[model samples]
Target: MNYEAVIFDLDGTLIDSMWVWEQIDIEFLQKKGYVIDEAAINQIEGAGFTETAEFFKKHFNLAMSVEEIKETWREMAIKMYVERVDLKNGAKEFLEFLKAHNVKMAIATSNGREIVEAILEKHDIAKFFETVVTSCDVEKGKPHPFVYLKTAEILEVAPSRCLVFEDVPNGIIAGKNAGMTVFGIEDAQREDAKRRAKDLCDRWVMDYNEVIDILKE
Candidate 1:
């Protein structure tokens, strides 16, 4: 596909930060005297931090407000995202290729702005993206198409001319629903990510190298 712009989902797509969330969930639940379960994780899979906190409150009957819960999670995960999270294989090279080709780049992420900016700045790749649009910026998150569409609009790129790179099913659906081509990045953190990518995306790749090759063609 001939693409004029590239939009990326931060966690699991450009950065390997999914593990940080998994650990946060585990630690949070253990502290609350609850055990982590697949069902609980699934419930929050595609949700943003605020949405996830809402789920936690209702599921656990917690006394904390949504803001408090979100703040707690941010406190738990921000340091890790900044200090430990690193770019996925070939991510930096691909970003450089897009920059060299003058292809506009932006980030559409469900992650909070604090951590996203921290990780990107820490890796010195924040300069590559013209802007970062978080779920907090939109009323709805992925699978709704609002976030992706907003990113395309902000970048002044037509949805048809944009190519979205995502690792999760909701994000894949969001890109396609917004009338853009979506490429799936393999993320081992989500057990079904590869299968879902093949099922929902316009293209699927194990890493950014495969995507670079596709763009080179």
Candidate 2:
């Protein structure tokens, strides 16, 4: 019952980052004279920067570059991740357990590399993963399967032999579409987020602490 590799989604899964995205999105739109609420933020949470920017452009009629949208979003999240958003309960302990067990680990996140690295380093958990796959590194992001697929390929592990822990529906679908077993995590405060994704995930758990037990089963 051993898996060869473990792939992780950064936000919400490894850390309490879901609600922060809403804040960033809402603030970014407000600055441009647009109003956004829970419904608006939920619709864009799992999308890549480009997709999210496109949504904003169409919704608010902005002419901003995707990079600009990404930069502005990162500007809000980086400080929060660094100054706040402590690792989810048992995330560090779980990482150490994986390292001790010699589990091959990688991060496949829709977050930009700059922000991802900042959070990982700030939390002192960057060394646990062998690779960090961000949206910028791939032509496609989550819910498209490219990022998770590329990660398993880079780790030289069969898709079926890898397990993915994700907090968003997009990421759950991406992992399952890649032929990996997906475990969904949730944040109680983020009620607007989809708890299901294309009906492809294997199991839904509330925290990372439950991962080891699932793997054993």
Candidate 3:
């Protein structure tokens, strides 16, 4: 695909940090005397950071306000992101390839600004992107197309000329809804997610290496 700008969803797409969330969810909910389940986790799959916090508050009937809930999760997840999260396989190389080709890039993520900034700064790849937009920056989250469209707008790229890389079905749908082509990245923990993402995305790949090879052609 010929594209001008490349927009990435951060968690499982640009970084190997999805596991950090899974672990945080387990530990957080367990602390509140609740057991996290697949159904509960699925409920917020593509939701933004604030939206996810709201879900936790409503579903779990927690006494905390949305902001407090977010703060708690942030505290729980930040150290993990800063200490353990790394770029996806070949992600830096692909970013360099895009930079060399002068293809504009940006991040459209559901994660909060703090976590996103920390991880990007940790990898020193923040320089590659023109902008980094969180779901909080938009009115709505994935499956709504707002975040992706917002990123494209900020990049000053038309939706049709932008390419999105996402790892989840809702995110793929968001890119498609924005009238952009999307490539789905495979998630090792969820085979079902891979099938769903494949069905939704324009293309699917195991890692950024495949994308680099294709773009090299």
Candidate 4:
């Protein structure tokens, strides 16, 4: 388990911001005279920011362009990310440990760059990461391996030497697809979803503290 670089998924994995998106989805659809449902949410589960917007426009039959949809979500999300979001328990400590070890780090997130930057700065943890790559920076999002591959490339690390921390099945698959070891970070997902994630990842943990303990051994 000697990984030279670590890549993380931002939302549910690194921070407790997944709830923000769930709320945004409900409000956004309500504003558009549509209702949010399980099916609608499932359709964009592993999508990148742009891909999610595209899905929203098409599936919701909204008149807003993809960019407009993205803008609306960004506008609704930025304040929450900057003010309300916090890192998951033990995340900062694990980050500090990694930094002390001189391990390279990066983010491969489906979230927009604006909110990601805002939250990173808000937490004052931006210095811990060497790079941040959003799904918009690549051709596809999670489950496709594009963003993960792009991040490893930016870190100048081979895929085999990289470790990815993810919360969902798609993100775990993306890391594995990139030929990196994947660790599943538990989030607020349903039991079934958590089981699926565990099945896909090389390891699983409820928080970064568990990882720190393991590494210390």
Candidate 5:
């Protein structure tokens, strides 16, 4: 794509952490005497942790504050992210290739900073990223473009020179709204929005290997 910098969304794009969220949601809700069905899960697929927490509070009629709900979800998901999550297929190789080629890389994610740092440190690839920005750093999350813009600003890269890789509709729109080229990556959790996601981006790929292959050529 001839881009100078790359921005990645963490959960489904670079790391296999969506399953961790699914597990946390199912377990947490079950413990609270409520079980969410697939349709319910789909509705909140691309939302940020805080948004999801708000949904939980309103839909499930929970009495917790948004911050409290977010913290609880974080606590439930942190152990899984630190211990069980791994990079998406071909993610590490592609990241290393970018590093070798001197392409600036950064992460713009909706996840909590603590969990994101822990996972990156565990994978030993934290150094590859020039900045790891979370939605919390900005006033709004995905679909708003604030986080992605903040990331590009931190890397001192022009929005037009940055390419974003994302797995969800909100994130794809965020990159486009930031005036950067956006690419969609497949993630099973967002299967229902697969076609929509592809339509929203400059390109779509099933995995990082597909992107790497194209970049190499």
Candidate 6:
């Protein structure tokens, strides 16, 4: 592999939380006397809090600040992280391999820092990532390269020499825009996830085990 550092996406890529948003988003909409279409929620999957919250506020015509909307998600996510989140298959093993190879690793997430830190600490995976950046820390979320570029820059690695592991099209685009390699993770439950991911990603994998295979090459 021609890479010195790896950047990762947190949500669907590192943990399983696709349907978790449905409960919060739907309940919030219902509380606002609005009905949320399943399709709309599906489309919002993998989006950052700001992006998703903005969509909800605008599309649903909800009277709430983006921060407030994001807070709801954060609150729910922290609970889920403590009570629900589990590492994606082979995630730990892959991390161990990266550590063994002395590969530099960082996380660039669409999720807020609070939520990200909770999961990392809960799973005891904080040590695996040398640095962490959230959308809240940057001007824009995925599909904008600021966070990804920042990760590469902070790690002192050239864009072309970094590989980004993402499960969504937005993050994939961001990685590619930064001239870095993008590897899309596939979740079998979300069939369309792969198709959407391939639209922008350079490579695809079913799981972190597949990543191990790629690194071996």
Point out the worst 10-residue segment of candidate 4 by lDDT. Answer: 37-46
TM-scores for the candidates: 0.95, 0.89, 0.97, 0.97, 0.91, 0.89
lDDT scores in order: 0.86, 0.79, 0.90, 0.91, 0.86, 0.82
Off by over 4 Å in 4: none
Q: Model 3, 1-217: lDDT tens per residue?
A: 3899999999989988789988998898888999887777789988999999999899999989999999998898889988888889999999999999999999999999998888888999989999999889999998889998999889999999999999988889989999999999877658888788899998888899999998878
Q: For residues 1-217, what per-residue lDDT tens digits would candidate 6 score against the true structure?
A: 5788988888778887655666676777778888778678565654666877888888888788988888877887789778977889999999998889888999998778898888988899999998998776777776888888888878888999898898767678888998999998875445565688877788888899988998898
Output the number of the lDDT-best candidate. 4
Clashing residue pairs, backbone N/CA/C < 3 A, model 5:
none
Q: Total clashes, candidate 4?
A: 0
The model with the greater lDDT, 4 or 6, is 4
Q: What's the CA RMSD of model 3 in angstroms?
A: 1.1
lDDT of 2 by residue, 1-217 (tens): 4778889988888888777777776778778888886565666655776677777877778878767777787788898888878888878877887888888999998887888889888888888899988765788777888898889989999999998988767778788888999877766443444535424467777666786666556
Cα lDDT tens digits for candidate 4, 1-217: 3889989899999999878999999988888898887887777887899999988888889998999988888999998888888899999999999999999999999999998988888999999999999999999998899999999999999999998999988899999999999999989987887899999999999899999998888
For each candidate in turn, give its C-alpha RMSD to the true structure in angstroms.
1.4, 2.3, 1.1, 1.0, 1.9, 2.1
lDDT of 1 by residue, 1-217 (tens): 3788999998889988778888898898888998878777777766776778888999988888989988998888887887788899999999998999999999998888888877877899989999999877888787778888899999999999999999888888888999999888888755576677679998789998888898888
lDDT (tens digit, per residue) of candidate 5 on 60-139: 89878989888888787778887788889999999988988899999999888888888888999889998989887888
| Model 2 worst lDDT window (10 residues) | 190-199
Off by over 4 Å in 6: 38-47, 188-190
